[model samples]
Target chain A: MGSETESARRLLTGWGRTAPSAAEVIRPATTEALVSALSRRPARGVIARGLGRSYGDVAQNGGGTVLDMTGLDAIHAFDPDQGTITVAAGCSLAALLDRVVAAGWFLPVTPGTRFVTVGGAIACDVHGKNHHRDGSFGEHVTALTLLTASGDMLDLTPEGTPDEFWATVGGLGLTGIVISATIQLLRVDSSAIRVDTERTADLAETFAKLRASDDTYRYSVAWLDCAAAGRLGRGIAIQGDHATRDEVDSVPPVPGLKPRISSPRWLSLAPILRSPAISILNEVHFRRARTAAGQIEAIEPFFYPLDAVGDWNRMYGRGGFLQYQFVVPLDREDVVHTALELLHRERIRSTLAVLKRFGPGSRAPLSFPMLGWTLALDIALPAPRAARVLAAIDEHVAESGGRVYLAKDSRLRQELVDVMNPRLPEWNTVRRRLDPDGVFQQDLARRLGLTGASP
Target chain B: MNDAFGLPSRIVVLGGGSEIGQAIVAAIVAEKPADVVLAGRTPVTLPDVPAARSLERIEFDATATESHGAFFDSLFAAGDVDLVVLAFGVVGEQAVAEQDPAAAVEIAMTNYVGAVSSLTHVSTRLAAQGHGTIVVLSSVAGQKARRSNSVYGSSKAGLDAFTEGLQLASLGTGVGVIHVRPGFVKTKMTANLKAAPFATTAEAVATAVVAELGKGNRTVWVPAILRPVMWLIRAMPPRVLRSL
Candidate 1:
């Protein structure tokens, strides 16, 4: 019984690696064992943890048991005709993508990295660049098995447990642990993306072109100039959609089963971790993209450009980094401009700043996305008075009824969260039903007093 | 997962205020602890347990047999419980017990009948959940009845047998019962008594329980050598054993 999992008390930290906490971690091999552990009613409580990619303490439970769900990774069911896969919550997107891609199917939504788990994606309701075209990750999920605190398993679907299901999605793993899920996948002819690259002269051009033609592209994302003096926000806008069989034919096939132009590996490029380094790289990258470029690229490089470099997170240095993502209504385009200027004025440097348009607010109350523009900025940790900078930006957002992403936030004030998520009361009603005893808890929940685990 | 020292994560000691039970909880938590639920009749004094996120103290009366079902149902419904320590028992003075049949019955009911009621509920709940361990604190006093504490001995003897039955019944269910027998342990229950030959301390009993749990043993005789020594005690002539 004292195997690798036993006697191995590890210091667990979220993906940000900022706030580390010691915890007893157990990996249950089967669904029954997992349920038993959950049903035991430990005083410290337990929370299901996946790959821990959240840039905050959402996955860590200080002085509690963190159920390492990664061990329960299983591709349980797959129906080729339906183009859907029923998989364990712990199955990583990378693994699922590999299997489905070979079968001419692709994930309905994928974040910037392919390392996230289905459970984490659902808990965070992770939104990808194509959220404007489709929706957040939760929209495609047809059904999932929710194991409540009482150890009873509930088959929750978009229809079966409407309120509970939506509440579970983006509910921050507080309602219950996602045992397994069946999600709809998009069909694709080939494993490639047809991309068009355009260099925006300034923020004006970028927003104009994006707002004008975002509907044309299934996926679109812009790499912004975080350190621009005169031409701030001038960078590259990359737009793409799954390549059809005809487009695949138009682009000459690589000789001898090899890609003609091997996808550019991010590692081949010089490290751009520091603010100054990123500024120079952005300048050069922007200049190179002044001319329009169109190419057929592998699906991976196009969707998960950062995944090409293993341990890319280390680039943020030992201090780690924070991904502060916020969304303001479309009518408040001024909020987006004011926000970039505020970061510049505050002298808070962000190495990677991205701007994307969201189609409409998701039905999931706590979800990060809503109609209008969402800006995600990755700022290195230990920035001076980080709280102040975030609070200032949050004020600008809150005034316009905008909200920050809970999955990525580490410093959002409790009161601020209450004000931001208006659907909190509705979500709480359903949450209490799933975990009435407040058995499921984590560091994030404890800090914010979510799920009544505070006492 | 056990603690960094490889102790279990969540453990509930039924006799919340029992010195020996508290010692076991302290020892386990001191080494490795995620949560500790000390359930007993009295409010517990929590140890300096920084590693545990929660040290829940619940008022649990062992003689309340009728409430065992709802108590355990609520406990299981609350959260994930990994291990349960059935450590509630009392040794009524043999003189007082023999003089008053009611006193003897009270001793028997609290020590034997109460445990049966609690353990039965625990066994069923854990088995239904498909995982967990129930560690019952039996005693070597049950190995053979001496005149001085025959009443206590008889109670433990009944508990030992009941636990054995539950252990066998739990096979393949993932839930298991462990019977732990300590010989004349110097605890609060035996504070003023003369130390018997080979008598152990509560701390020693706690250490043994922790070690046995690590080994996943179904039966543990504290001061491990007692396994063979008890055989000799059982074989001793009743005349000689009674004299001692």
Candidate 2:
């Protein structure tokens, strides 16, 4: 570790907006180095940033050291007999998924985006289409090596240090920096996914179909047409599970099948993304998808479609986009429809509107899932009249038994967060117990008043 | 701006009828606090604070301590309160207060004991929940006992200390306590007083408080230069300072 200013200058967090002008970004390639670094700066807060996927400030800590975990990505040990893989926290989910699939294993849970790091997934307690079945990523973490605020290295799991473990699971990197994690992986037949697609006429039909069919599939999601009104919640529901090698051959080949092709690096540039030429390309791309029921699709097409587009977030332009994700309890399904109706009534266009069924919630106080339905919409920012429209949605969600996901929220009131997640106090208590001095702090944490500043 | 964090972050001035309080509330409400709650002893007849979504009223009486808890409980029970401006107090004539001990006691209780008890209850709940900020109005006149308005000054002194303690106790707790101390504000409370140095209006104090709050400061003295002046006043020998 260098001087405080030096350490502070090197921190590059996920999503360019939150990267600290870190004086020094410590990349501990090994556990010993990580431990040494922690011992050296016992009083400073450390945030572990992986792959930098969080849209806002979940992983960056200004004026403090950032432990870039990506360098510690190597898998330490794989116990095939126990189906547990102990790896460094810096490992990317995409890399983990690829390696695990090759070994007939898969992550018990994965969020929509696979580029996230294992530490990030656990820190945010990320969830996915399979949340209705498997729950959040934290649910599958068997154990984690947490370097506490006091520089004590503790191995935590659901059974060991249960409270601290659960709190750190969704603690948003406030508890301490995660050095490594041992995750329990699920066994799968093959890397391919056997998917079935169906288009629903409206919201009611979609809900009924999901309620009836979700239990049969391991992963389920709906591409909602938020612009549709009256019928309100209409969209295409796609459900799937891991495909056996035999089932993989039955599906029609995707038009462009280059399994070995690497993502083009040039696509990550901002100028190419913001040009009007890309919008036409996007329009053509949307038009190419043929609407059909019971259509079989490949796993890559269904799950990681966006992964193919390098730096897709750049499409939203320099202002970036805000991902508004909230879940309405089943009891408040009517409120969900009312909210969708209002969005449709306003004709606020969101490029990506995903609806999914959540089975039950995890013990994490601010966890985003519950026994009901969740809708996530990615709206391009700087759109005309977008603020007013989002406010209307926030009011509707508050009235219902729902709250937005903090991991994805760039904008939302601190007060509304209090209402939506009443469990925050309990979680904060745990955070204080671990970080009594309030060493850990981030932009999102500050914005949401998670950590009190030193006077 | 309210949506920046995800809820309506509006501010409401309970005593829009108050000149100094309303000016402070108006300035804060301008920064946008999601919504404004403009409750008063009676409906305030004034222009609405700009940018505040709506100004609603609930009949509030500073002297009505018993009703304070229920009134505030019901008000904040909706759970939308992010920042509350406790600007309800009375500054009666010193001669009248001296002649009528009961009136003086009422002023003392309303400004110090009554307000503290009610706000304590409110702050307790807000602290347990770990959110919301309480903005309490205090005066530099309370920094020490003054001959002109010792009764009023003493009441403010108690409030000022209580708020400072609240701020200290609330550390590590999500709830925040902001003590706003302004000097010589040209409001009804000080309208009868002779002109003094560094005299400011309610609007000016309010602007300073709102700006300082955004900077995450715990306590603020309006007309900032007065902060050093206050220190100087504190350092002066008692006999010499009294003569001034």
Candidate 3:
């Protein structure tokens, strides 16, 4: 009997899997089916869910109807001449790349994982390590089809419908369900990256090296050893760009897009993921890197190394882990140091930490990337003192004119939303016009008070 | 919503007057400031815990079973509650309970019937909200019934069973349940009774339960030894149990 009821209601969660909510899920394989699902108008409202890789509650609609767009995944068109492709909102980047990579094309921008759906990418306005060069995913989108609250499909683009287009970009799917989208892909000769590796002595050196080579490198990121006490900010900087035919040894077999191994559900490494063990792991990783330049690497290892280990999040245990990512302006780089010092003082250990430099800010109101340094880290749950310490850092970041990434945040305070995302009011104005009835809602919207008082 | 450390930002205590209940709230507030709501039939004075951000009291009668559905609906309608401690229960004297049928009925109604009614409503609300922890203060008395305290023991037994099942029902919903079993916790309710073996205090039970909340533990035994002791107590012969 319990199994019957449990099967009826779908329990949804983000990649982090920290907070889960149950909802009635409806998969629409066609436009007509999507419209039929939308017409139901559940009392709690409706929202769209993709591959569920936003890291938080961005894709969840608790007690409401969730449109599982994965069923509508069909590549509508492909224009190799124009370097563009039109795919369904539910289409995964991995699937799209698999079709395009062999033909010398790639996603203009991508996050750490390629399993995310096209709709989620535009909804989050995801940025890659090349954010310093190419901006965000939304910037590369040529056009999109939005199904508004009133049940009207509107074709939108940056120029044709600036307000609605930008609103849908990093909109967290609150505006409406995205039906389909046309994205401009980057042209590549081979599926390999010519990389340059540098081990920085400290945070300042890493920042200086990144800033010094900002224009020279098309893509760059640093892996910081936050757990190392004396060598607190020491890191390894990896910068690279797509390799031409001459740069790689036969293009690495067109790059395998699927995950080779999956992490078992029963296995848990939480006990050993503590401070002592993590510090040792961090030390070994730091020492292992060499100052090698022009190292040829496959696209898989260069961008999505963790993706190879499927369901890697299970390693954090059932309590789940949080990925706290915040971006501070270039001048406020000291905030990064303060956050690391505070975490150390509170005796909190971050298992993984990545530091990246972003270029100019996005036009979209809720977009996360800006011309600054962003530090993202993962902390295993039940860290008793982590709340107070992270809240303190949130305050400092807000005051320093920085913002945390909503796509990755699970516990950011509601009051800090306005201060961090100053353009929230502007986004709300556009969102209200598009969804005046407020038919689309999500858990992240309610938790962070993103939307005004509930309908 | 819980913060980064899993510290509940908002907490609700059903039996506001229970010493063990108030102690649990104190333990949480000691860690960090949180908004607390104490609900009971009798109005409870705001505890002077400086760490608590805000303390509010409301009327909540355990025996009023029919009103539970509406009561919880309104409570959750206001906002999401992170932690809810169901501590409202009466410990009636077994001697008086056996002699007076009405007394035994009152004890059963308050502890078992009322718990079922209120917990059913609380679970529905928390499950819909998708994130929260329900802490149930069960007892070692429920481990096995004693001839001396059969009525009260049986009442706890029912609650213990219900809470265990509720924990399973709540799986995958992100709602956690902590079934707390304490042996002879010395509180105002148990002040008149003689202290049992390996006796503990209400504060000690509170500390253990609060610590277990962050660990994702479903069952907590105060003083820690009651768990092992209960094992032996359950295995004892009926003839040997009757002597005690």
Candidate 4:
């Protein structure tokens, strides 16, 4: 405890590098230190940050204290027979997967980037391509420990404390600080994925294919070429599952976890991407992908292709970029079409657009996913005109009983909080009960009115 | 905190009663800045915008350079201020000022000396906080002195240079400084004078300032065409410029 010193302030932003803020970041290497640090609540309060994978301000607290949990990253125990792993909250999913896959186990749910920590995974209740079949990361958790604002450590489980567990699962780190968690791991034969790819001519075909064949595949997602105006919704549907030993002719070494090369920080392809050249580039990509089946690929490329290029966010330029990801109920598929048409009409091009079908949402009130169609896109900043289009989309989403994922948001209006997530009141009640003084807070919580009122 | 689109949530206008300052605040009313501080010599009435969460007035005299340090310290100590607008200046009539040295000095003191003093304190406070931007309202008259308004123009010239230098000094401090040069804005300052070429209204200047801030631009021209117009005007030799 005596070793701890006053940490210097750091300017932090999410993976998207937008809306950065300054906070005094303290790295607590032990649970005892983390708890002690939380006990002294600064005026602006404290929030925990992992690898800063969240796209916006979810992990930031301007003029506040940010607990850097990466220090307490020890994987305490692993049970092969029962397929359970107990690890500190600061342990990153990349570290956990490397260890588990070598032992014939896999993460039940993984987001696009494996750079996220266990604490962030539970805080956002992240969903993966296999969400329709396996559910979110929080659904697989067996037990967890939370350090409440009152300095009380809680041992929570789904069965033992449903209210506290569900609330903390997707609470956006507003309820309390998650110290450590015990997760249930899935068994896999190899660290390879058996993938099937197909090209869809337009939005209709892509939707039809995903709706028809999504059930057969354990994991499925579609990448849309939005710049292709001729075939507006043109895309490629990718589906895959963990490969069995019999399915693989020969097993290759596990792919490297760290990115080998990084995109130049000064390089900005935004101007070119915003021009007609985007249409040609996306068309070439669409034409290059051929219909193929039974292709064995490494897990790294299959799960996190962008992770191959570190600091890829810099490609959008210094102004940074925004990832607008939203989920609309399955019946409101027209909203997705409306969004694409609006972007085309406005002459705004999305560098990368992804479409997926989500299963039923979890018990957590603020959880973003539900039985719906979700579209995520990357748009460069300084496109102030994009704000109007997004606000209109937010209205449509809220009206359809859908909502934008707070994890990937930076520009959402505060008024839409209740309309989008009706369960917010319920979540806030539990959050307030846990931290009556609201000692745990963040920029996202304040920006979106996540906790209702500031402490 | 800035919104997802980079619209600042907390805004401060040093020259609170300045027409251009209020116009800029009014322009961003739709975004709903949480806190708006209007500090000037006199009590300033709230703008027409009712969507703002809180609007407060504090007494700040630009001529009172000695009190600026304490004034800014208490303001920033309250909380993090996202945007600061240094919009206090006087446009003295050159004809009346050439005969009266005291009047010329008054213009110089208010426009140049006052700005340097206030900005020094504002910049220090914002830099220490690690996040915030200061927008200084300069004038196109500062581009080159006209015999018609030499006193006012020269004062603005000093401010323009200081603001740009402060921008460089602010590098790596996480604080931003933007220079806003408006050609001719129609407000109380120019109400009795003839409208200049491409003369704009205070509302127009506000619109451009807010939009440029959103784009994270270091400098902006009110009408935008003035950028090219000023370039050509600057190319003429002093011998040819003396005819005006």
Candidate 5:
């Protein structure tokens, strides 16, 4: 049965497809329907779900009402001259990317998945490959239209309603149900990227390369080869900037040349899910010479390579997988070294890890990254000493003034959360003030006691 | 074409409308952005296939073998084709085949002679281009002719033999030919048949073919165990096999 229904109970999970919870799901096709659903929330409370791409419990509400935002996917207004688009929160970034990329404008910031909703990007303040230059997704948002717990509709902005705006940004969707928003898009001459790649010997060299030359490139990421026996963090450091129209002049006019309208469908990783298979893949990947100068590539391949495989989580077997991403300040790169060493010592098998360097954070108090190195590792679920390994990493992340991304995290606790983000009390105060009746709540909020529910 | 990434940069599918052809194309494109060309008689659409950086369609009729040479010449004139998937054929009803020998010849020609003509031109282009993979779709039915449908089985038998010969010739020439022998694939052609032993989905075969492509192997048997099973089937007494 379809999960977008108001009357029927539907079980829902995030992109990780783990820890599913049943909820009363209602698709709000119009603002009236959304407001009506919010006004009459059930005992378990209500949360808004958009594309269900949050990776954790953020989009689910057990025994509660979940507003499936996809029904509201529509372009309310578009101005090519101004390079801005006003769209419903439920509209997927994938659907909107087609129109923007064709027009030679792009989203200022996008996470790994383009299938997520614009509202989810704002709620999580999601960062992307260009975070070092552009910052988080919320920074590009011009305005947000929200439905509060008291049945009130409020318009907020970074400059106009700075408090409410920052709170709602990375506020974990606790402030209210996001109805719609105005977003500013970046201008580009073409959809191609001019990429430069170099393989690093170890963690030290990789960190040095990223720290020294990251500012030169609009996008930069390091694919950490965790499977390499002695060279733990050895991998490739890729940097790229959107290719200018002139840069692609060498590419002869191919008849079918056009910007990719959507990301590639998911490819299953089941065939190569075993550790041996992954190790071989990683070894093959790591031996691609030393460096490649520059090549013109499309945006999707540069930004979202894994999007090609559908249901990639299936590769982890039926037990599912967890993506543990944490960010520490620029000075504490050693904490990252310690964490990887710990994983190696534990004999925990993880494929190539993804590492990104963040520039500066935004006004959002609960924003995950803050001028540091963010490392993300995917581990098989039911792994050996899974809890102990993650807990150890979490302790180091917190102790080193680092914090885990709430959207990407599924195992953080309450007190450690406060330690990670000292501004949690302030965010909680703002959340309580905006949703005093606690009508806006979901599984994530309940799990971490963010909305006063005991964990 | 992708010397650095190992993901094929340009792929050409001979029978875009065939379920097996689309599956192989989908698998290759999933690895990375590869310019894909779909050539078929009908307009083919690959649903759920990831967004292609560039996807082109050409009207192609396999029965029109005269155009095979010029088609390959132009397709490979400007760029190298990394992989060519051959999955075009017709399996006519056995009753119609028995009633009219002309209808039976039409099916046989379309499945065997037409495929050979097209593949010959492809092999020449790939050989000159220096490197590429050619995937030919054969079936288990070709392993042992059945009483119910000997015409289709014989046609597949010819295809299997021809592709294997081509594979042997292309060795060390940088041209790879992958002969895929699957048992009872649940495609439109096999929809009417009852659930056969070891029946497989088009996607299951697609996955297996894509995995084998990585190993740079010449032949792949779907369900894998079919390799040993086909061995036993080939060794089975003709009387006992006919009775089954």
Candidate 6:
């Protein structure tokens, strides 16, 4: 057994703050060891983490041991005929994408960042731009291996253990330790994206174009300028889908097509993140988007722009930042405009503001996306006055029948959570049955009362 | 003092003037425990400890064992006492203890026997409730009987062992016992002791304990490395262990 160390007790709560404490952190190398360790001491609460990408406390359990699942990453099996791959929970989506794309197969869905673990994706029920066309990553999952509180390993799927399986899909690691999973992969023609990029003058124009053009494309997303008021939500909208080999010949060859190249590490640092610097950069970026032109672009550049900057999260400074992502129904498009108008009126300087239209809801009850338009903003923390502004926005979202993404939430109040996601109680019930001892608990759980278990 | 579960949790610290106890209470208060009770023999003389608005105070005496049961029963009858922090004990000179056995016995009973009786009553109620956490303050000196302070160390050792056994027996039933083994802390109790290596302040210990409580830890050694140090000490021969 490895000795618990203070250095291992550090965690990056969704707000990007490294909360340090003294804990007996245990990194189990194998599923057997993980089960034995859990059965032996039965941690008061345990949270599983991989690459620490979560913007909030979903992966952080104060004072409790965090099961760092990254070490358990290992590709187990691949069935070419079925286009399915089975891998340990800790295997990164980036690694899988690289390998799968080489074989003409691609992940059915991927979040903006490819560095997240499969288990992390399932836990958060992550959605991508294509969510309007396809569903969440949970929809592509075929089966999972779960280590329950009783130290029993259960293989679950939609058919076998439907309730437990669906619960675990978006259960946020509260159900059990996900050891491995078999996921069905989508076949693609090439590694290129057939893209059409356009810039709109304001919120109205952007919404009009998105609603009209989204049906023609498999992937659609927009970057809104939250800092702009009367013409709030004005920004660029990009739409794309997998390109066939024939389409690439008519367009200029895309640059930097490989996925393995490491993005420059210093781009996210404070030296470039200052408000004035960001504003200047945004102006240049807006000027570059002159027309609705089609281009052949590398999939890496199209989906994961930030991936080009390694460790980009560090750019937010030591205090870290909060990634506030909330969605409103299609009918509440006016609310989205109002939200943007408020941000612009407040002159709140956000680093990045993304808008996407969600296609449909998944089987997971608490999954984030639905038939709505989602807007996500990244704001730096320690903004003493920003909390009030965010609370105002939260009220707007709740009134509009929208909810904030739990995976990205850090500073939201418990009261807001209770009202936003009415399914929380049902999710808690399923969670309690799997982890009867309340072993899988975290700061998020404690704050939001996710675990019905006391204290 | 609420149990680990924080249900029916009502903690009352007898040493209202103790900095260590006050810090522990402050940490416990953050858990949103049902209630907190601060008490002392001379409750009127005791200075106000920073407490949650939900916390209350009353008169308590460690030596008054005759009324201890009834006093606890009344509190329980009002509500359940999930946890009780027995943070009332004395630290005195080894020379004084050796010269006067009566004074030594009083100190020993207050630190050990008195704590045992009170904790036993609280533990029984918690066991009935089927969930709780008891935070007991034990000292690192109890890792081994020290020539400098064997009497006090022995008392802590007895309390530590009892708490460990209690924790073990309560397992599977939801009741938890946390044995807090802090090194020399700059509390009112250790104000006269020479500053030692790795000594922490009461607030630091309190913070560590609170963090550990959230994690549902059974045993915690402040400056955590002491757990290994204690293990090494236990593995050493008697002659070597004593000399060290």
- For model 2, the superposed segments whose C-alpha errors exceed 4 Å read A1-24, A32-45, A228-232, A250-297, A452-455, B1-244
Residue by residue across B5-94, what tens digits does model 4's lDDT show? 666767889888889988888777564445788887876553444656678788998889999888988887776687898988998888
Fraction of native contacts (fnat) of each candidate: 0.00, 0.05, 0.30, 0.27, 0.00, 0.00
Ranking by DockQ: 4, 3, 2, 6, 1, 5
For model 2, what is the C-alpha lDDT against the true structure? 0.69
Residue pairs in candidate 1 whose N, alpha carbon or C atoms collide under 3 angstroms: A39-B79, A40-B79, A40-B80, A40-B81, A41-B79, A41-B80, A41-B81, B16-B40
Per-residue accuracy of model 6 over A49-102 as CA lDDT, tens digit each: 776788776776545667787777888988766789999998888878766776
Instruction: Give the range where candidate 4 chain B is weakest over 10 consecutive residues by summed lDDT.
Output: B44-53
- On DockQ, the candidate that comes out on top is 4
Q: Candidates' DockQ values?
A: 0.01, 0.04, 0.35, 0.36, 0.01, 0.03
Candidate 5 residues lying further than 4 Å off, grouped into runs, are A1-6, A249-271, B1-244
Prediction 5 global C-alpha lDDT? 0.77
Q: Give the range where candidate 2 chain B is weakest over 10 consecutive residues by summed lDDT.
A: B1-10
| Residues A115-229 of candidate 1: C-alpha lDDT, one tens digit per residue | 7889999999998989998999999999999988877789999887789899989999989999999999999887688888887878888898789889999999888887877
Question: TM-score for all predictions?
Answer: 0.62, 0.63, 0.92, 0.90, 0.63, 0.66
lDDT by residue for model 1 over B72-167, one digit each (tens)? Answer: 887867654657888888878899998999999988988899999998888777554434577899889888888888998999999988888888
lDDT of 6 by residue, B1-244 (tens): 2211222235667666677888887766554433567777777766554545355667887777777898778776664354567788777788889899997898788888878887888777755543456788888878887777888888899888888888777654445577899888887677778866678888888877666442233688887888898888778899886775
Candidate 5 root-mean-square deviation in Å: 20.3
lDDT (Cα, tens digit) per residue for candidate 5, span B19-123: 888888886665444678888886545333464557888878788988878888888764557678898888788778988999899888888988999889988
Q: After superposition, how far is residue A220 of candidate 1 from its true place, in Å?
A: 1.2
Point out the higher-scoring one by lDDT: 4 or 6: 4
Query: Which numbered prediction scores highest in TM-score against the true structure?
Result: 3
Cα-based lDDT at residue B40, candidate 5: 85
lDDT (0-100) at residue A309 of candidate 5?
55
Candidate 5: fraction of native contacts reproduced: 0.00
lDDT of 2 by residue, A243-308 (tens): 776766653332132223454544334433332443344345434545554444654567677766
